[model samples]
Target: LPQTIVDTVVTTWRLEIRFLWIGSQCIIQDDNHDKVIEISCMPQIYGNACLTILASRSSSVTEGFLHERVISNDILCAKLAVKVFDQTAKIAHLIPQRKNVELEPLYRRAWALQERLLSSRKLSFGSLQTRWFCREMDDNTSLKDDSRDGWTFRERKGWEELERFELLGHWIKIDSQTADELSTQWYFLIDTYTSCEMTFEGDRLPAISAIAQRLAPRLGDYHAGLWGRNLLSQLMWTRVNKSKLAKDATPSWTWATAVGHCRYTDNDLTIPAATMLAMLAMTAATAFPTKISGAASAVTLGMSVTATAQAMETVTPCFILATLRCWFTLLKY
Candidate 1:
């Protein structure tokens, strides 16, 4: 085991936790079967844990996170004196910069993304200080000492709260309101997850399998990185930049096949409705040509069909039907 992991174990013991589930130690690395089972159970393990310790400061296992942090001396602090009715009080104000968790080495790892999201409470040992994050509150030890001069730290509470919402939203029961909401959030997650570095291209889907498993109950079916229910909307994902397809068994239709950052088409009217419809239609034709050519073509279009149905309120349904009939007739030939 690496020293960082040993330090983590020691930290867990200090917290009085009896058992610790170290991925390297608990899972049999040599056995593929064991890895698959363990990886699938990640959601349960991390979600149920009382506390998850993150070595955010360490890039690799060899560089232990327990080492001292080099505090910068460039911080500015001002002491002010205020006169009350009878007495004078002094206040020391320290300007602090918020730490960006995304910049952390551990945050870049593909596996760590799901691990962090799954854990209810995370105690991250960052380069700046030891931070505590949970659904209720997020704090850091650096802020406790008011007398300290250099570089006070402020935890990014907004980002932490957003993460908590993302975690909770997945487990919530699926309803009309939550279904679309959660599906949108899932796309946002994919945008972030795909940007992270992965050592093995094949592990892309497996790394996020726990998240998929957790969401499967609410989202219906799991089809690669895309969900089954709103597959047409999900297929609206587009690559951010030029990227190559993965040399894996994953189908080209899914985002998992591409080894690059991708984001969903923003429904904010920035993209023309016609263009969006065309993209959705093309995605359907490419991904499910058989289904698109069959009687269930409108059903397979998912949200695109709904949008067209709404538009039909202004236009004639017969005209639209005839147009689609001609289109499909040509598609068949």
Candidate 2:
């Protein structure tokens, strides 16, 4: 373990936290089997924690986050002398703004994305100042307000909303409005997550597995990072830049197979008529094996109609077809 992390453990002890679960210290690094088990349990580990400590300033494990921060002149308030009723008085006004947490090295890591989202409470040791984040409230040592514009605030709101819906567990009762909100949040997550940097390309799926598991109850069946319920809309993702396909077993249809950042289409919530027909046809084809012959014909027709619709909508037809083919192939097994 790094000295900084060791010091943090001591700090936790001082705070009367009985136990601290450090990934490096707790998990067997060399054992892939153990790693897999631990990785899957990340949601529980983070979500259940009283508080999660983040070394936001540190670029690497070895670089300690405890170093003194350099504050700017603008942040420091200047004292002013005033005369009120012939009595001298001194006063100062300060407006301490919170630094952008997204710019931090820790926030840029792909694995930390889920960690931040899952943890109910977070104590971030940032470069400018330490900040605290929770579902209900956020505060910093500089006395920053919640009105700040930053990714942390936005993600916190998203997580809180997700928690609210998850607690209710009546998504079907609320209908499309609720489903659309959830779907929109999920796509936003994908947009943010794919933009993060990862050390190993293979860790893409494994790193996000915890998040997937966390959302499974609300989102339904997980199919290569895409939900089965919104499979058609989820398949409408496009790469931000020209990138190579993943050299792994990941399906080419899913964004996980792409090397670079991927973004979902604008109309993720609005399912077109052709897509609806295609989805229904595919669902019938897979759900009822006895009606395969009839359903397969419908599927073929649906696919053709979907391709035409996608082209008309200015979406990549080849991409949609590839996704449909891969989805069908997966359903076969």
- For each candidate in turn, give its C-alpha RMSD to the true structure in angstroms: 9.5, 9.8
Q: Model 2, range 233-284, lDDT digits (tens) per residue?
A: 6777889977666786655667888877988765323333323123223434
Q: Which number leads on TM-score?
A: 1
Q: What lDDT score goes with residue 185 in model 1?
A: 70
- Residue-level error in angstroms, candidate 2, position 280: 8.5
lDDT of 1 by residue, 1-333 (tens): 788988998898889999888898899988877887788678889989999899999999988899888755554434446666756754434343324556788878888987787787889898666867664533342345533323333323334444543334343333434665677678778888898898888787788888777776677766667776766556666787877877756666678878878777553323222221222343443443211101112234332322221222232212122111111111111
**In terms of lDDT, which candidate is strongest?**
1
Candidate 1 overall lDDT versus native: 0.63
Q: Give Cα-based local distance difference scores for all models.
A: 0.63, 0.61
TM-score for each candidate, following the candidate numbering: 0.69, 0.67
Among all windows of 10 consecutive residues in model 1, the one with the lowest summed lDDT is 322-331
Can you tell me which runs of candidate 2 are displaced by over 4 Å?
Answer: 73-99, 136-177, 267-333
Which residue runs does candidate 1 get wrong by more than 4 Å?
A: 77-99, 138-156, 159-177, 267-333
